[model samples]
Target: MTITHTKAMRKDNTLLAITHLSQLLHYVTGFGGFIVPLILWLASKNDVEGMDEHGKSIINFQLSMLLYILISIPAILLFGLGILSLIFVGILGFVLPIVNAVKAANGEAPSQFLTIRFIG
Candidate 1:
């Protein structure tokens, strides 16, 4: 690739990585998980070639996790199974985003297992 192409690719990769990692903002803002990613995606998706796909994947994963947690809430009455599910969900929520971010940085598409495509 030409120098300009390579530079643009690097920039896109960085933006995509940020889109994936922005989910961690939730820990600080209490609700930035979705908001941060959404904003990043909206701002860059049109400009970055692969950003639309990456953005959708991140959003879908977040929404899927939210749905899982909501479902687990009622399972609290089922012998405390909800607590276990919640813990598992929390761990996945923390790990998957980081993994995806790394993949994006490497110029690889992120595949979020168990994610429901809510934005596709």
Candidate 2:
């Protein structure tokens, strides 16, 4: 006789919402936005419904924003266009998480605009 272990996944909208909202940590502490969701995703992806997809979205969005920020830094020398992009990034960074959190809480998929697919 052989025993097989099966992992059970549960639906936890609150956790998913929190994970989305966790991206705001960057604004408060200047860091941990990516790390927190990454940790939560890694810890619960196998045990939570929708965690994998939401996690990928969050990670991809964060990475995309970082890339934009990096690109903007150099564009700063080009007639201060970088400053505008930076401001846009700032606004998107602050707004998207909240919107995604609400969507997560409502059991809806995230809608992250201008996000590059880095993690899928």
Candidate 3:
């Protein structure tokens, strides 16, 4: 590939990886889970090809996870099952983003399971 092509590919890969990994913002900002990814995706989606799709996926997954957490709150009254669901959600939230980030770095599309399509 030409140097220009390589550079562009590198940029795309970086942006895609950021899109996936930005979810970690939740740990720092308490609500950065959606905000950080949304900002990154919005800022880079047009500049980097495929970023729009990846951004949408990330945002949708975050939203879905939030919904799941909200639902789990009520389940807490039912023998504390909500606690288990929250734990599972926490694990998935931490793991899936890393997995997707790796996929992005490898120049593959980010595919998230248990995501709801809120933006698209």
Each model's RMSD to truth, in Å?
5.1, 1.2, 5.4
Clash list (residue pairs), candidate 3: none
Each model's lDDT:
0.87, 0.96, 0.86
Per-candidate clashes come to 0, 0, 0
**Candidate ranking (lDDT, best to worst):** 2, 1, 3
Superposition error at 112 for model 3 (Å): 2.4
Identify the leading candidate in terms of TM-score: 2
Q: Please give me the total number of clashing residue pairs in predicted model 1.
A: 0
| TM-score, every prediction | 0.88, 0.95, 0.86
Expressed as tens digits, the lDDT of each residue in 1-120 for candidate 1 is: 655544353257888888888898877678889998888888877678789889999989999999999999999999999999999999999899999999999989898698998887
Please write out the lDDT profile of model 2 over residues 23-118, one tens digit for every residue. 999999999999999999999999999999999999999999999999999999999999999999999999999999999999999996999998
lDDT of 1 at 114: 88
Give the candidate order by descending TM-score.
2, 1, 3
Give a tens-digit lDDT track for model 3, residues 20-74. Answer: 8889888767777788888888887767878888898898899899999999999
Clashes of 3: 0
